[model samples]
Target: MVSKQFQFSCACGALLAAERRLAGRQGKCQGCGAVFEIPQPGVLSTAPRADAIAVQEVCGICQTAIAEDDPRTLCQACDLPYHAECWVENLGCAAYGCSQVNVLKVGPDIRIPSPASPLPGSRQPGFPQAGQSPLGASGYQGGALPSAVDRAAASPTLAWDYLWMGASAVGVFLSILSYGGPSAVTGLAALVAYAFQQDKSHWGPAATSLLLSAVGVVFGLRLSLLFWQAT
Candidate 1:
């Protein structure tokens, strides 16, 4: 006996098919990656087999006749048919202005219940409600909390700052003793530190380290020039 298959549309508008035995089971959409329950038999309107309608139906994305037994899907928004691969490749419905265009997955429609109004004279112990002075009840008179950027800017200097500064100073001392090779290496270290610190949003330390490193590099270069001139 041939197993019957049922067709249904995913929330993201992709057409899907499942066997009768698989009805009411959760299935994932291949085209848009949505997980949905396959409708039980008689619940969803089943379409005729692709083999029976191959002559008239074509894939919307490739404009090619859909072959019998080929994996296929339809855009729920516009009812446009597409090969499974074509639908996934195009990302969503190819029809212009279709709500499912480029949509990977559609979330379930959820209705949020509005907060109930408090009964008169009943106090909820928590953060101050709208229009209530935070200072009056919570004693939080420091004004608005610091933003993320402000907190980042106010962050204390990291250990890497000291390491970079020390390396630069050592390089400057070594340059005075040698001919400035160590200074170049330390200059690169300082530059790396600046980039790392700047990426972490430690602007003050990054700038300070870079400035000191620049001075050391210039001093080292000047010494190298004098040493070479003497030679």
Candidate 2:
């Protein structure tokens, strides 16, 4: 509720921090038999959550640090930390920031088998995904991959569709003049090439416009071939 300045190591040998203070559950350490007195503000710390492997302890909910000295028994899903009074409702730990608003508590019975079919365009158009990491342990090898920014900076996927479409435009003109049948093929090829470009260069409105232009070129070529062939 409030980030208070308190440090009370459970005399039961549990840790506590300035932002997160807890009374030993029922005045006794649940993990180890110990009693704790809330440490004074200056006696406790206000540092970022730190561990050997976990360089940072950010709450998955509010993205706040679960301070290093604080009891980590609290779930990152809730922002509110456990206090001497409210430890009971928290299942007896100092869970913080995870109010469970957008939480889906997974268990053995409720199995989430591969994203329930993504709801046909329910993805947020162009947003980075949520929970996009392996938790607890790295079960697979070489699973860690580069981020979007890293890939883009390394070797940008260029707009090759423009080159193909431009060449196809010349082919379309040549087909109208000489190879009338091939004119349709060239225009169709332009559309196909543009589709490939759409897959990679979905950067902004400009790339979209280029892809749409390729489509328009296909229509125009088809129309010209029809009219010219008829005459």
The lDDT for every candidate, in the order shown, is 0.53, 0.38
Per-residue CA lDDT of model 1 for 1-231, tens digit only, reads: 555666666676655666666565445566665445557765433454463211124566776655667899878887766888999888888888998788764445655555554322223121111222212221222322344225324332323334344555555665654555565565554455444332434445445645655665677678877887889
Clashes of each: 0, 19
Residues 56-127, model 2: lDDT tens digits: 233323334445575544545543443322343334434334365324334468767675344322232321
Which candidate wins on TM-score?
1
Error of 2 at 166 (Å): 21
Candidate 1: misplaced stretches above 4 Å?
1-157, 197-199, 228-231
Instruction: Give the Cα error of residue 31 in candidate 1, in Å.
Output: 98
Candidate 1 overall Cα lDDT vs. reference?
Answer: 0.53
Estimate the overall C-alpha local distance difference test score of candidate 2.
Answer: 0.38
